[model samples]
Target chain A: MPLSRVRIVLIATSHPGNIGAAARAMKNMCLDKLVLVRPRLFPHEGATARASGAGELLENARCVDSLEEAVTGCRLVIGASARLRTITWPLMTPRETAQKVVSHYDETDVALVFGREHSGLTNEELDLCHYLVNIPTNPDFSSLNLAMAVQLLAYEVLLASEEVTPASQQGQLPAEVEKFEGFVQHLEQTLTDIDFSDPRKSDKLIRKLRRFFMRAAPDDEELNLLRGILSAAQGRKSMRRDETSKE
Target chain B: MPLSRVRIVLIATSHPGNIGAAARAMKNMCLDKLVLVRPRLFPHEGATARASGAGELLENARCVDSLEEAVTGCRLVIGASARLRTITWPLMTPRETAQKVVSHYDETDVALVFGREHSGLTNEELDLCHYLVNIPTNPDFSSLNLAMAVQLLAYEVLLASEEVTPASQQGQLPAEVEKFEGFVQHLEQTLTDIDFSDPRKSDKLIRKLRRFFMRAAPDDEELNLLRGILSAAQGRKSMRRDETSKE
Candidate 1:
């Protein structure tokens, strides 16, 4: 649903092919809203050729002269930036930005504004955005292409919207904490009685073993089975103690 | 580590701008390997301009005549496409494809092959790929730009290699099942002694409880505490039964 409201805004694009490519990238991610601010060329053969079959997107793309005009009604504006500027803005990774966009896209319009081919968005242009999304790149050669940046951002947004269900959420409910605690107390007493664990120095061992079982997260059957073993051990230890006393 | 061994191969690229853009995208994602197959133009002004400051990538780009030549030594080859062809090939989403690339990258050369702008890879070209990578796009307008596709795939690979640490793996080893089972049996016996559960009909409830506890998966101390409660409950029930008999 957010896919329909999300817009791709290109600012002062120098090459016509980039505009075409940007549109194509949007279309690939199921994002069709496009706004171009002060593009040097539009409705060109090179753009058409590069767009391949997605020329319709370029045809419908809105061309505006100013960034202000480009984002008139948008509630959220995100600027894609490659540089670490002197005046630091709230910086977010592309993944984080995508999450924000996906969450707010359905309720309000969202704009992902990109800058020119050579120099990126000016400081003034950056100020217009609520956050600057940085695509982590190789520090030695961090030269990301304009269309490619759009593609990465758009791809992430699409992924977020798809809402891939997490493995944990799939129907299995865990036991209550109180019940599990009861089982542990008996086990420890049994261990101490059996001389498997010394109460005075078993703190470290208990912590490590606790960590181990906590990670495993056994269910009721599993937990019950474990408790049964501990009880049996305790019963056996008590019998042994009685026999020793008699002897 | 696979980042160094991965190669991006573009087959018969007609537009120099795309090549430049692809190079820039590669640089931004920390991927440096580039292979061009019989491009129409190389060392062109358009590509240099589009590459922005990433001209160094273009300068060192490899140009070969044939696809086979381009991917001569690569151990793994992946083809990018938006279409589902007649002969069905094992298709993976960009994320899945990226995971494969990252995993195999360290041990062998991995080639991500992109076809010409107009018509993507040929059937013959696709035959060379172990799997075809598809970016999930809007079915209505699935027109993704070549460089943009490259960028999305590259971004995913970079993310996978970053290796976000899973919480479970950080610490806390899981408890063994056999230990956990012993506790369950003891608890069951105590419940039966206290008349909390009918031995024959309680199987269903016991199974459900087992599942519940299994999901919760308490720590070592938790298990011990639970067993102690069961032992106490059993003792109290036996005392009550003896009192009732005497009365």
Candidate 2:
């Protein structure tokens, strides 16, 4: 089976539109399968409406009751939670998660499970899975929407897959989330290193750049290319400075 | 000039209660630096009550007027939003926003700016930020309390700072998301393709299943793993079905 064999399951969804949106997210990554556990509202126009253009996925979804039945034959169960619990399996970042799940493709069934809207997967439900996956989020605000989480992971999967390459440009691009973030972090370090973080601006130096790049929203691939260029230029400049000083 | 330099700023916040709560969230994530920009009513009884003993955050809270004063020297300004398009800067979801801010922490002071309760950061106020941060929410109802959003992003920054992940465990489980989600999705498709819909139980089946997975909440890495395995199973099942059809 190909990656298409995977399933994305949602439990106790309260909003119908979320189901549709989740379908859209999955489809955006070419994932078609969607399962709903217990929803407060479903088969509602509101939900389908929210699904936007992803109606096909919504129409082709599966509805289940118990968590057990939803994943009866699932050899691997991966749960989502923001909490760090006393009793549970090992947790992996999304990137690691992709590798582990793909590793199990030949051996058994697998399930990507999520909990409700207001509250996330409880400790009890997490026990079903051999592993847990946590999105690297701000601890101050860690609640991610069901569909958004699916979209984030789905995007990561595509990145990790054979189809993935640095988003093509003349040079390598920092398109991956973590990879791009690394550059941003590195750039910040460079600014601090150079003492160019204009203090008169009251942190305005970095804040403006955050706004600029965020608005610019460089794709990971593009970011890498740019950063590489930047460092190269900086490296040359620094070498010249060193030579001049020696003279 | 590490992430320690990044400051979370709340501006013209109307609710004293939310202010206290926000402090708690930041503290939990190990972020102490907070700046209040033109709070409507601060040092109020409500703020202290809601703070739940996180008085240090409030006591040490820097109170300033005008967004200009709050973010004067801050190099990076990230504004949180749910609605689209009114601000000058391009928008980013909370996750991306967090990463963007984190990247700039070393370069200059980064401000995680939040707006008023009545309407959120105004166009003018939001214009202060270089980038707008949107938390992915149900399109129908994407509103998240200010404190919750703070908690999530703060958590991510802490993770970013630590860099080192603990040995894999339930708290940080390594899931196989792709396979599990794929299985759940395939199972749903099978039921649909096979016409297993019990009219009365259709909703029940879907909802419960979704909730179950929600509880499972698989991460990015695991999803790819599950998808590979699931598509495999579905591929085999389809092949069998095709052979039977030929007969």
Candidate that scores best on lDDT: 1
* C-alpha DockQ of every model: 0.16, 0.06
Alpha-carbon runs more than 4 Å astray in model 2: A1-76, A79-88, A94-127, A134-247, B1-3, B44-55, B86-88, B93-96, B163-247
Residue range A125-216, candidate 2, lDDT tens digits: 54345457877654554655566567656654544554343233222111333443466566665443333332444243344343234323
Tens-digit per-residue lDDT, B131-225, candidate 1: 67777777777656677777778888888778642222212222334445677688678656644455777675566455445444444566665
Scoring only the second chain, what is candidate 1's TM-score?
0.65
Model 2, B1-247: lDDT tens per residue? 2245778888788878779878866766667788998888999988887565467889999999787888878888888875786434687755576677666766888888877765788768866778887655444434555665676567557666766766355433435656565656764663343233334445656554544344445544434433332232233322212233211
| lDDT for each residue of candidate 1 in A1-247, tens digit (9 for 90 to 100) | 3276888999988878778777777777778889999888887887777676677888888988888888888889999988777777899998899899989876898999999878999878987899999888877766576777888898888878876723111223335687677776776676566545557876765665555456445556556756654554455322212233211
Indicate the residue-level lDDT of A219 in model 1.
55
